[model samples]
Each structure stands twice: as C-alpha cells, then as structure tokens.
Target: MQRVVSNLCNLLCSHYEITLISCYKANETLPATYNFPTNVKIIYFNEIYPDFKLDSFWDKVKFSYRINQLLPNGSKNILIVNNLLYPFFKKKNTIYIRLFHNSFENAYKKYLYKKPLFPPRIALFDKLIVLSSKELNHWQKLHKNIEVIPNFLPSIPKESSPLQSKIVLSVGRMDKGDQKGFFRLVDIWEIVQKDSRFGEWKLHIVGDGLLKEQIEEKIKAKNLQDSIILKPFTNQIEQEYLQASIYAMTSLFEGLPMVLVESASFGLPQISFDINTGPSDIIENEKSGFLIPDGDLEGYAEKLKALMQNQNLRESMGKRAKEIAQEKFSKEAILLKWQKMFNN
Candidate 1:
C-alpha cells in the first residue's frame, strides 16, 4: 500500500500539489519510508481523532466522517483511495477514484460480501481502478466505472543477475501463513529437496510474519534447516534477488504481486502456482517461467527440479524474463498511464 502511494506521489508531485492523508498515527519511531517530493503534504487522521484504533469499527466510522468533513467541497480536488475504506466516505463534490490492490474475488470477500455496509457505498465512487484485465472484467460485472492499470517495476535493474547460485527464492509476510501459503511452500520444499536432481539447490524464504516460530518448527521437523533458509525482511532485497537463480511463489492469491515484478527485473526464472490473479499476469508459461496448477505441489516440485538441473533452460528463461519485465512494466510506461488517468 505504501509503495503504490509513494510511487504515485513521486510521479505526480511535479505537476500537482499532493496531500497524503492517513488514518494512522505518525510518530518519530514509525518514520516515513518513502522519499516524498517537497510539494507533497501529509496529513494524519490521528491528529483529529487521537484515540483511533485501526481495528475498531466505530473508530473507522468516526475517522471516515472526519475525512469526509476534511475534503474540499469541489470537484477540482481529486481523491484517490487505495483501500476498501473508501466506501465509508461519500463526498459530493470531489472525484472519488478507488484504487483496488487486490484480486476481485478477494476484494468481493473483504469489501462487499463480508461487510454488507460497503456495497451501497461502493456506488458512490466516480471511478474504480483494478490491477489486471481479469479483475477489470470481474469488477465490470458489478460496477459501471472501472479501469485496468497494472503495477509497474519501480526501477529496472541496470543488469540482469547472474545465475551463479542454485537458489529458489520466495518472499512474503509470514504472519498470514494461509494467505501466502508459506506452510505449503515448506511442504513443497521437502519434496524438492528429496529429489536427487535438486540436491544442491536451496529454498530461501524471506520476510517476517506471525507464524515465524511455527515455520521454523516445520523446517526443523523436516530436517531442512541446512537446505531451507528462513531470512528476516531486509531493505537490501535487491541483493537477495541478484544472488538467486530462480524465484518461486506459492501464494493462494494476490494483488498483482510486486515481488514477482522485482524478481523478473533481476532476470530470475520464476515458478509459481496458477493463482487467481497475479502469477498468470506476470509470467509467460514455459517462456519466462513455469506456472504450476494451483495446489499442485508435486507439479511445482517437478518444475523446480527441472529448472534446477538444466542451467541452459534457466539462463534462456531468465533472459526472456528480464526482457518482458523491462518492456511491459517499465516505470515510465506505468507512470504515463497514471498521468493520463489523472488528466481524465
């Protein structure tokens, strides 16, 4: 969420005066990670409602009401909301643009179906933004105003990462193990490690989460401590990408995954499950990477093993991956799309 906001702010700030409004507290400890333009102004809702609990329903309602009151009563001001909470603020004069960062199915569950309060409020928005054509199609069935704009690679690597190590990399927050399918990856790694063809290759899982201890336990139980490395989140993630030969994702579902885009920019051949939205959008099957059938652990292991054994195939796919990422998801191309949207 921060990446999308920061990237858009960085791109659009030159032409417009941008004000970023947040519902959370801005303290010294939780400093701004992104470098915002000098023209951009950031406003935190906690200043008005200091006791706001992000998880509490009543607090969210109060926050929404405050936000609605804060917005200028004129169409000249454009409001782009990158969260489900946009439905709560039904301002009359402003242009409300919703930037949905999840698959339509997930969005349906999170914003519309589960929370009955949102469907009617959803109609209040002027435009809805989706990540893929699949999501756009799905959302169009329910709403009239929608657009498809994919997430872009923030910056392409200057040169492709050399495939020197036999490493298969997977990155995501481990706290929500079910969502990211981290447990599933551990099981898949067990199968991959057992295969003689991939004996030397290691599975490197990156990012921290609530299930860190449980994940560690599973790795130890399987005696995969040596073969499977669990790494804490790091700012120097690009270095990790450069050292890896292959990228893997077992996510049950996703918004258009930024990790896949970053990995592809490094020219790493990817192998991911054919989830609802993301992997298919990024990877070209058997070209840039392999897309295994969803929940097909055996197939995933086999594909991983095949890639690990064949250096030539990995190199060829990695080259294609870099080319596709650069051509399709360049920052300039994506920024232009946003610029057009803003103009419209």
Candidate 2:
C-alpha cells in the first residue's frame, strides 16, 4: 500500500498538485520514506479531527462531514481512495475514484452485499481502477467506468545481485491470518528443512503485526528458531531482497502484490501459490518461477527444493524474471496509464 501511494505521489507530483490525506495519525519519528516533490501536500485525518475514532460510527459521520466541508465544492477536484467505498458527497464538481487493490469478489463481500443484494452507491464514482484484466471484467458487470492498470515495479537495481546468502524470502504483514497465509509458510518451511539438500538454506520472514507473537511461538514449537528468522519491518528492505536467492509467497489471495514485482525486478526467482489473482499475472510458471496450486504445501516445498539445489536453474529463472519486470512493468508504462486515466 505504501509503495503504490509513494509511487503515484512521486510520479504525479511534478505534473499535478497532489494532496495526500491519510486516515490515521502521522508517525513522528520516521522520516518520509519516499521523497515527495515540492508541489505535493500531505494531510492526516487525525490532524483535522484529532479526537475522531475510526471505529465509532458517529465519529465516521463527523469525519465525513468535516471532509465534505474541507474539499472544494466543484467537479474539478478528484478524490481517489485505495479501496474504501465512501458515501456520495453530493457535490457535482468532486469526482470520486476507487482504486481496488484486491479481488472484486472480496470487494463485493466488503462493500456491496451485507445482506440480500443491497445496491452499492458506486454509481456516484466517476471512475474505478482495477489491478488486472480479470478484475476489470468482473467489475464491468457492475459498472461501466473501469480501467485495468497493473501495479508497476518500484525503483531497484536492474542488474542481478550476486546471490551471497542461501536464503528464501517472504514478506507481508503477519496480522492477516488467512489472507497472507503466513502460518502456512511456517509449515511448508518445516517440510523444506527436513530435506538435506535445502538444510543449509534459511527462511527469512519480514514484517510485524498483531500475530507476530503467535508466529514466533510456532517457530519455537517447530524448533525452527535457527532455520527460520523473523525480522521486523525495515526501510532498507531492498537490501534484504538483493541478499536473498529466491522469493516465496503463500498468500491465500492478493490484488497484485507489489513485493513480487519488486523482488522480480531484483532478479530473484519467485515461488508463490497460484491463488485467485496476483501471482499468475506476474510469474510465468516454470519459466521465471513456479506457481503451485493454492494450499498445496507439499508441491510448494518440492518446487522450492528444486530451485535451491540447481544454482544454474535459479539464475536462469532470475534473469528471465528481471527481464519480464523491466519490459512490462516499467515506471514509464504505468505513469502513462495513470495520466490517461486522469485526462479521460
């Protein structure tokens, strides 16, 4: 989410007057990760409504009222949300856009159908942006104004970094239980560790969340403390990607995981479960990497073991992955898509 927002801010800042509004309080300690252009302005919801609690229905109403008051009362202004479906502002001048970062099935379950078939207020929006062609078709059934714009690779070294560490990398927030399928990776790692060919390789899990303690306990119970390393989130995450030999994801579902795109750009062979949406769009199965069936832990381990044992195969796949990322997901391509969307 940070990568997508930062990338847009960086790309559009020079061309447009961008104002970023966050729904939460700004972190005081950490400096801005992305260098925002001089024209970009950032505002936090907490700064505007300091006592507003997002969990409270009344507070949300008050926040919406406050937002309506602040925004210009004309159609010239554009309001883009990550995925949240807000109530219609009723002002004719403000255009509302919902940029979906997950599957339409999930978004429908979240916003449209609470009970029976409640009509979504989505008609209020001027446009909708989806991550894949599959999502575009699904959402087209519901609305006419939609476009497919895949996520782009963030700035990373184009050359393949020397694989100095025998490490398998997986990154995501641990708090998302079934969505991330992080616990499933712990089980898969245990199976991989049992194989002598992969005994020397270590699994590095990155990011922290509410489930961190539970994941730590599971690692201890499985006696994978040495083999499986859990690290907190870091700004220097690109270095972690460069050091690792392969990338792995066990997500149950995704829109289009930016991490996979970023990892592939660094020339890392990726192994991820073939879930509903994201991985299949990025990985060329058995070419750039392997995309095993969703929830097939044994198959995932076997493919991962194959990559671990064959250095030549890993390098070949990594090189192809880098080429695909560079050719298809360059910043220039993505920026053009967004510029067209805004202009249209």
Candidate 3:
C-alpha cells in the first residue's frame, strides 16, 4: 500500500494538490522506505498518540473520533479512506471514496462486516474503489457506487529475464498476523523438489515478516535447505525478476497482486493459485502463466514442475506476460481512470 500510495502521490501531485495523510507516523521526516514528490503535502496524525494502536475497544473508539478532529479540509474536496472502512472515519457531505485493497467477500467473511452496523455503513461513501472486478461484482450488490481501478505498475524494466536460471521467485510479506498463507509454500515446495530431474532447481523467497523465522523452521524440518533459499526484501526487486525463470504467488487473498505484474514486466512465467480479484486479473492463465485451483497444492506443484522442466514454454509465456503488463497496467492508463473519476 505504501509503494502504491507513494507512486500515486508522485504522479498525481503534478495534476492536483495531493496531501498524504498518515495516521501512525510520529515524526515529520517521512520513512526512507518510500519516496514522495517535493510539492505534495503530508499530514501526520501522531501529535498526540505517537504510538497509536487499537489494542482495546476504547482505543479503537478514541482513534476513530479523534481522527475526525485532525483531518484536513473537513468540508471540502475528495477524501479517500484506504483499508479503514469505518463510518466514523467519514466527513459530512465530502465526496468520500473507500479503497479496499482486498476482496470484499474475504474482508466481510473475516471481520469488517461482523460489526453488525458495518454492512449498512457502506452507504457512507460516495464512491468505493476496489482492486479488481471480482470485488466489483460482489460490492456493487450492496452499494451502487463502486469502481474497479487497479494499482498502476510502478516501473517497467528494459531488460527481460533470459529464463535460463533454475530459480522460481516468490515475494510477499509473511508476517505472523498476515493472511498471506505462506505456509502453503512449504507443502508445495516439498512436493516440487521430490522429482530428481529438478534437484538443482531452487525456490527463492525474498520477503521479510515476523513469520520468516517460523517458516525457516519448517524449511529446516523438511531438510530441503539446499533447494529453498530465503532472502530479505530489497529495493532492487527488478533485478530479482530479471534473474528468475518463474514467479510464484500462493497468496490466500489479494486486492491485485502488483508483484505478478512486476514479475511479468521482466518476462518471468508466473504461477499462482486462482484466488479472487488479483492473480486472475494479471495472469493470462496458460499463456502468461498457470493458475492452480484455489488451495490445490498437488495441482500447483504439477504446473510449477512443468514450467521448471521447459525453458521454451517459460520464454513463450513470459513474452506474453510482459506484453499484457506493459499494455494493461501502464501508469498513464490507470491514472487516466482516476483523472476521469476525480473530474466527474
């Protein structure tokens, strides 16, 4: 979300007066992890609660109400509330847009809709921006005002992968509290390495989260240390894409996996479970990559092995993947949609 926000702000700031409002940031200096345009204004909400959190019900209520007082331009312009879909966070008569970075069904199934008043509170927003059409279909039934505007690609690489590397790259957060469902990778990789033909192949997972240690334990237990390599996140993710032959995503759910699009830009054949909203939107199935039936470990392993065994197939699919990403998810194409929405 930070990367997408940073990218959007950097571009949109040129056309509009963009002010980034961050709730948890304590100091004025923005985090070095993300860059911003010089002209964009930034509002940090931690003047009072420097270490804000919702550990208690009182804290939740406090944070919600106090936020109203701190918000800039209380009664003018558009307000986009991302991830937090609370009625209390909205302003009176302001053009509000709620951005859901996850699928509507899973979000409701998990927690947000369980609040009893939550479902009805969908009416509060003038518009809702979902990451994919899957959520668009589900959300439109409840609220008529919804848009399926995906995240724009941050950058396109000039160099594409040669597809000669024996590496299958996976990148995503695997925090202990995350729903990324990375444990499934362990089971899938275990099955994948059993084939003696691909003993030299490696699954290189590049990400950082609290679950890294626990996942490392599982990898150690399987005694497949030589087959799977875990690396920390890097700023040079495009280099990682260029070095890999295939991209694998086993996300339990996603809004839209930008990583898949990023991987595609570097001409890597992709593999992902047919999860809602994200993967299907970017991947062209057998052409760009393969989509295993959701949660089908056996099926996922089979397709991954097939990609591993054939360099020609990987190159063919990867070429198509790059074409789709370069055409569909271009920054101008996506921002044009936003420009129209804002103008309308």
Please, what is the whole-model Cα lDDT of each candidate in the order they appear?
0.83, 0.81, 0.82
Q: Give candidates' CA RMSD values in order.
A: 2.8, 3.3, 3.3
Q: Is candidate 1 or candidate 3 better by lDDT?
A: 1
lDDT of 3 by residue, 148-199 (tens): 7888876677789999999999998987665666789888999998888999
Q: Rank order by TM-score, top first?
A: 1, 3, 2
Clashing pairs in 2: 74-93, 74-94, 75-93, 75-94
lDDT score, residue 72, model 2? 60
Clashes of 3: 0
How many pairs of residues collide in each model?
A: 2, 4, 0
What's the lDDT for candidate 2?
A: 0.81
Query: Residue 315 error for model 3, in Å?
Result: 1.0
Question: What TM-score does candidate 3 get on C-alpha atoms?
Answer: 0.87
Q: Between 1 and 2, whose TM-score is larger?
A: 1
- Best candidate per lDDT, number? 1
Error of 2 at 335 (Å): 0.3
Off by over 4 Å in 2: 22-34, 43-75, 83-94, 115-118, 176-178
lDDT of 1 by residue, 1-344 (tens): 77677777887787777888877754453326676666888888777677766577876667667777877665467888876365466677568888888787875756565678666666767898888877866777557988788888767988777887988899999865367898999999999888776778888999898999999999999999999999999999998999999999999989899899899999999999998898888899999999999999999989988888888989999998988888878878887787788778
In lDDT terms, how accurate is model 3?
0.82
Q: Candidate 1 has which clashing residue pairs, if any?
A: 175-209, 175-210
